[model samples]
Target: MTTSFAQVMIFLGLGIGIIILLTAVFRVHAFFALLIACFVVGLGVQMPVAAIINVTKQGFGHIMQSLGFIIVLGTTLGVVLEHTGSTKVMATYILKRIGEKHAPLAMSITGFIVGLPIFCDSGYIVLSGLNKSLCRRTGISVVIMSVSLATGLYSVHCLIPPHPGAASAATTIGVDFGRLILVGMAVAVPATLVGYGWARYAGRKFNNEEPGQAPVVDLSLPTPSVLLSFLPVIVPILLIGIKSFIGIDANKPVPDWAGLFMVVGDPVIALAIGIIMALLAVRSWKKSTVSNLLQEAVEKAGGILVIIGAGGAFGAILAATQVGQHVSKVVNLQALGIFFPFLLTAVLKTAQGSSTVAIITAASIVQPLLPALGLDSEMGKLLAVLSMGGGSMMLSHANDAYFWVIARFSGLDMRPMLQVYTVASLFMGLITLLMVFILSLFLL
Candidate 1:
């Protein structure tokens, strides 16, 4: 069916709104909620049900085709690092170096670094555990730990290539990975600082400061040698960075013969390699049995698989809505007078909730305009890249899975959660946008 511009707008808005509400308010799992929403839109638009199912599968298939292994490897590796106590060591070491007064800063920095290769969800869980320990020991609030963890994990995940959202957005928008990361980092520091301030203030206000409460840290958990824990997290990022910088598409892939390594050696394999080496480093003071450790990792991987697959399904439904074409037409020079790209991405992110989807959707709509909008020019391209990325950071709420996760783990009520996580996200996005605009002023 040829969806008219107006018709597409109406349906797309309804579809996007419903999916957001369903994901946020009713607390539906985003994957299933989005799946059902896709069905509704396809049917509402008068497409046959059969086509919807096929398209949904096709949507999932496409996401998994590129991202499936990365998600698996990343999550599994994060679990190993967390379970075997590698991340803990790194956090403590950072805390020691920087001091707990700067724990939020430390975690924020860590999140930025780890976010590149690790999935955000896994990174949050792993790093938050360590944050809580430091806070508990040092008399800090959960927000400090939570925000630090979030800032750290979200930084690289949103900005750098290789993370699914960034990678997907980059591929869709035609930005070079090496180049995007360079631009992303320039914007990321300001964003991180913005989130850090939000977290610090929130920490002071709401560190759960009752007269007395049970500690958040589970003291029974054995601490691994900090050196050992550092390796797994560090190695994969180093390898990927090396490939990106020194190799830069020479196809001189990290040698597969190097201990069964492949570009796909994944976070799991990477962490495992690090874990075994860490084990060797100590040789005596071990806590977990191999059987139990592997079992826990597998259990953790199950949730990662489900949530990720569901997100893929939701993305497909949006694609089916053909919102991209409608958005492209509506935002054109003849129509909306060629407004800013940052605003475009922010609106999509707020309206739609999935940053990856928002960025990719916005980029696709914005790409064809590169030439017409002068976006084909170097500064214009940079503006477009940062705008799409920064926009995806806006208005994170119940519509966003990250919002819910932060809400759940940080144990904040919805309103307060919004004040913190949602606002923090907006703060991050705005700072990124401003910096990009300033950069444009100079470059353009």
Candidate 2:
């Protein structure tokens, strides 16, 4: 079951090559591509054929078991917010309070908070109309607002839990979810600020054109109250954070009130509660409307679920190959510290254009090396999780779906899109990694 260092390198190369060829060159769907990569790695590492099947099945099942309810509930909450105009209400409220001069910052904050529950793509689509409105009103370039919004969404999507990428990475690496959330928030704030800075500069330089008439959007829907709109996201975060504070353990005696928080504070249950709150926040809660929204959410969740499961399978195969142990013997990753995970994930992300896949695979690769790398403590593992997230933020270019979403929705030409959003992603990711490194010195 042991792999030689040379065999590990070859397996790594073959695995990554298959992923790039299938997903990048042939345009195979990422789910199938990751599954294929898993099988290839399993075979290349000399796993028995029957064991490969069992490993793949177990890996896929394990990830889905950990992530299925969280992803589904999170997406459903987002769907309700988007379909019911709650997202818009929050966006509009933030813009009005911040006024025109600070619209980019406002949008950044909106994207950060909203992104906790919604996927970045859906969050961008939900808020694009609002972004357009802000541009027209403030005479700020759509480029700045778009980049700011994208940066904000990207920040939380990669780092924050219940966002699938972060959640799966945390789960895969066996980090505490609540601690990851806290650390992710710590890193996200500065990274988002870096993105906001880039957005402001890009707005002034590349998009100084006079604003045109804003596109017309339906304003007749009854929006949820601001407090009600925020409850879904805010409550779960608070509950989970509280649980982290109390330190749930069987060894410790639990009070009754603490027991209640423990049940509600579990990530799955908290998100499920958020889903119900989101459903209630909808202005008209007709059964048909609810049914349709659930269907749409499920459809979106299905694609993400498969990709995550496949990524898990891929990681499982890597572990089976004992690549981590081989790499540990060959490389002094302890010297590189947190940067090792970040660099590995950045390469995967830049190559394959999926942050979730990058995080999952990187975590799998790093999990077994934790002791060798001196990242075996809870704090160290949390840092590793955040490091992978930081890496996933790098180089969001043409191959990235989010790149196209910002391009098409924001009406940015290819050149400016590269300059603004793409370059900004690089900056944000680097700044985040730097921040994570600095924090690790103190915490780890």
Candidate 3:
């Protein structure tokens, strides 16, 4: 059972290489790929077969227990918003308030807010029509509009909770979910704006043509009012934020109302409240329509849940090797500090192309080394989680499904997308990392 640090490190690298090979090169499902990688790492590290299975199961179950309900509830809210036109209503409301001259900024803000409850790809799809319509009406290049929206969505998906990556990473790294959400939202702002700026410049330089007419939306259902449309997203954030603030100074005597915060402001409960509010968007709550929509949300969340669970399994197997302790003694990765997680996640993301997988794996790999890297403090761990989130945003390219979602939906050719959107992703991630770094100086 004893293995050299070099041996363990080699096996770890091999296991991750297999993940990238299966997922990226062979197009294997990440769940299966990650599971396979887990076994590879476990067996290579000389773990007993039964122990590997038990650890894998425990890891997967742990992640599901902590983060599963939140993901499902959040996905349900997103599905309800998408199907019921709440997403469009929010977009239109923002556009009206911001005016056509500020269309890209409006779209960026819309994507950021809407993306908080959903995956980036789904968020982009839900808003793509609005992006196209705005591009046509405002005479801004579609590239600008699409990149603006895509980057906004991308920034939050990588950082904010209720999105699988950030949630799972928070669970793995032992960071408070509410605090991560608050910090992530703040950090995401600069990244979103930087991405927006890059989009504007790239649009002018690339001059990509607009897509065809915006797809006609089904107008059968009454669009929800702007306040109702925003309620689901806003209420959950406020509840969670209040909980975080209440807990900030633990020495302060717990207030009598803290019990309520403990109940409604828990991330899972908050998301459940959001789902209940989202149900208001349904015009006719026929059992059949409601059932189907809930089913669709489950189907969407199912894929994400399994993938994140497998990532947890993969992390567990790696953790079992105690490679982090070994690596810490050999190399002063502590010196790299925050950049270590960021760079590691960036590599995993660029290689295998799933931000969720990248962040989860990086969190698993980094967890044991937290003490070694002088990041074992509460705030330090959060910055590490955010650092991984920042790294996961970079270098999205042809392999990323979200990239294609933006390109095809926005009518940008591959080269133009690579030039504008892909490049913008780099800057967005870097800017986010920069923000995290700055926060680290103050908080850490």
Candidate 4:
């Protein structure tokens, strides 16, 4: 019944390899791929067939229970923002305040803030016009404009919750969502800057290709005010942060008013409140329009939800093998600490090119290893979640859909895209990892 460390590692490698080969090479759907991986690892570890089946179902359901509604609520909020033109309103407002001279910086900031509520691909598409218009008007290189915006969005997408990767990781590792969000935002700020800085510097080295024509903005539609544009995003974060802070000092006497914040600040309730705020910006209250929009958000979240569930199943099987205990006894992974997750995730991200898959898979693998690696502490787990996020952003190339999104949207060719944005992603990932490592030293 005792599986050696080498055997555990071999089975683990085979399971992960199966995932990469099927997903990256054969182009199999991730949900099926992950399910197959769970079976492979389960069989390799000599687990009972019935146990494996039950574990898979349990793992999948657990992830769904934790993240399903939050993901849908967050996705719905994003859909509302997109349909109501609130994203553009926020982007335009920033562009005007920052002016054309600092257009790249303005675009980066816009992407960072807007990206909090939406996926990176959609965020880029929605704002690509503004990026192009800024480039044309300011005569900034399209390379700089595109990378700045892309990196800014990329920065937050990898690390933050309600964004799938980080959210799933938090659920797997049992970290506080509020703390993860606050810490994730802290790490994201520097990563965003590194992307911005790299874009401005390396973007000039490439030929300053003229950006494509800006997309026509629909001027007739009434948009949300800038202040109103910010509320939905900011309010949930504040509520979550306040609740987290109160809980941090459990010894302190709790306040009477804190009870209300606790309810509103729960991640699910917070995001639901956000959805209500997002609805306020909707110009049309028609039953059809609202129904269609909600449907769209659900549709968007559906694929993500399943993939995350599969990832959870995979991790459960991996954990069932007692691999973490074996590895902990055999090696000094504790010394490696945060870097283990960072490297594993970077490899997965580079291999498969889906940050969500990369982070979710990596977190599943790492979750079992946490106690052995001396990362079972609360802060250690938070940094681990972040470190996986750091890895998920590196080396975006042809395999990455987001890379192509930036490529086609900015009209940048492959060579330039690799040189500018791809390289920037590597730098961004490194800087983010380094930041996480330093935080581990202090906090862990």
TM for candidate 2 is: 0.96
182 Cα displacement, candidate 2 (Å): 2.1
Among these predictions, the greatest lDDT belongs to 4
Cα deviation at 343, candidate 2, in Å, is 0.4
Residues 1-444 of candidate 4 have per-residue lDDT tens digits of: 567788888988998898889988989989999999999988888898999999999999999999999999989988888877889989999988998899999999999999998999989988999888777788889999999999999999999989999999999998899999999999999999999999999989765697764456453447888877888989999998888988887688778979998889988999999888888865657787789889999999998999999999998888888877887888899789899999999999999889999999999889988987789998999999999999999879988989988888888898889988999999999999999988987997
Best by TM-score: 3
What C-alpha lDDT values do all the predictions have?
0.64, 0.85, 0.88, 0.90
Single out the weakest 10-residue window by summed lDDT for candidate 1.
210-219
Off by over 4 Å in 1: 43-51, 114-146, 161-164, 167-186, 201-224, 246-330, 333-386, 397-421, 438-444
Output the worst ten-in-a-row residue range by lDDT, candidate 2: 210-219
Measured against the true structure, the TM-scores of the candidates, in listed sequence, are 0.73, 0.96, 0.97, 0.97
> TM-score rank, highest first?
3, 4, 2, 1
For candidate 2, write residues 310-427 as lDDT tens digits. 8888878887887767878888888988999999899988998888877877888888889888899888988999999999999899989899888877777788788888889999
Clash pairs for candidate 2: none
The CA-based lDDT of model 3 is what?
0.88
Indicate the residue-level lDDT of 126 in model 2.
Answer: 79
Q: Which pairs of residues collide in model 4? A: none
- Each model's Cα RMSD: 5.3, 1.9, 1.3, 1.5
* Candidate 3 per-residue C-alpha lDDT over 1-444 given as tens digits, one digit per residue, 9 for 90 to 100: 898998898889998899889988989999998999889889998999999999999999998998889889989989888878999999999999999999999999999999999778888887888888778788888888889999989999999998899899899989988899998999999999999999988788655486744455664567788899999999999999989888888778868979799789998889988988888766567788789889999999999999999988988887889988899889997799999999999999999888988898888898988988878999999999999999998789988888888877787888879988999999988998899899989998
